[model samples]
Target: MPDSPRLHRAKAGRFVTFQFMPSLNQLLAAHAPLLVLDAASTRIQVGWLAPGSAHWAASFAEAGIGLFECLDQLQTRPEAAGAFVFCDGPGSILGVRTVAMMLRAWLVLRSRPVFAYHSLLLLAHARRDPALTVIADARRDSWHCAAIGAPLRRVPTAELPVRLAMPEGFRTWSTAPADLERIPYSLAELLPATHDADIFRAIDEPDAFLHEEPSYATWSPQIHRAP
Candidate 1:
């Protein structure tokens, strides 16, 4: 199949490239016995979708131990998974990175295909509301926003529109807007509704989503000079 369109976002005064995410339906059609991990919120969610199965076997737990607990519940070994799916975040950085680290280690043991989706994008597609804007905290009073048929972007909290939705369990540093909708983040609830939905993209390396690749200036020693 031909690849999807590339997405880009401005980071560090330059736009960074993003791979096109395929829809859940497309993923199901392409791979079987897929293992999915989502740790973008306070609760960690794991899902198992095997060949010819209509429903996903799901589990949820608190962040620190959730991934392992879900795997244990599904009785899945790394080798048993045909391919892996993960939610790369605009949410919990530590939790998302932890899952990414584990996926990297497993890939080293046995090479397999890996795919990823943005947390806000997934929620946006699931909600299927053109007018509703989905957001996650981006710190420093900014928020990551995703609307139907639009690329993800970071907007100032003050600039957010009236129809705003935040997924359950996301942490926020800024005060939430009035009449904000708390959308469900439970995979157990989402998968059944969106199993056939087209909204995932392929990824080679698993890691947390960064609007831009981090850049640092080299430090040099110099004698102090008075202005």
Candidate 2:
């Protein structure tokens, strides 16, 4: 019998890097090479970049798990290294943090390399050129959103500032606490199609922040809770 071909064996020295940057374009442009674990609600998308080629991974996270919680495949596969996680945020603040904790623990249990990303930016990367507004629709609190355009304006949780800035003909949608779907599209529009330049960035779980971020990044829009 012939030896079966495997990715781990096929490509050695390939490290799975977890890049938690605020901007996808920055990440992708910076890293000349890598693979990406672009996970989100109900789906985990993967993509790879080799020498001169760029392709997306058709394989994604399991069906039943929450966004960014897909680790089953990484655990089973004998890849060069463990998987990396780029978490998004803005709505599920605590849930986003919990997922990080979960990823770290999972990595420790499986001996994998884990990384982080500003969860909110994932959507920002997906939809670019919209007035990026993060609707902070928490169960118990009022709603809030922020504009990412020039002269960045942080919308008041109690009142969406666009209402006042918009011309008479321009329309702005209101995000109620119960309305989750309405806002995702709005959020997606702001994200520019992008990712880290080098998909693989070696990183360890963080216990606390040690220094100021060199770039302008906001940890926003967490949609779920860590349970």
Colliding pairs, model 1: 21-200, 21-201, 22-200, 22-201, 23-198, 23-199, 23-200, 24-199
Write candidate 2's Cα lDDT for 1-227 as tens digits: 12233212213544323223223443333342333443333234444433444444323234224333323433322143324434443333434454556556656655554444433333433444355454443233434343333222234456553422111111224434232333242212222344432222346663211123458778889889899
Task: Please write out the lDDT profile of model 1 over residues 128-221, one tens digit for every residue.
Answer: 7889999988888889999988889999978998899999999998888889999888776676566665567677789999889999999999
TM-score for each of the candidates: 0.83, 0.44
Total residue pair clashes for candidate 1: 8
Candidate 1 residue spans exceeding 4 A from truth = 1-20, 52-64, 223-227
Per-residue error (Å), model 2, residue 218? 30
By lDDT, who's the top model here? 1
**Per-candidate clashes, comma-separated:** 8, 35
Off by over 4 Å in 2: 1-83, 93-98, 109-113, 144-146, 149-156, 163-192, 196-203, 206-227
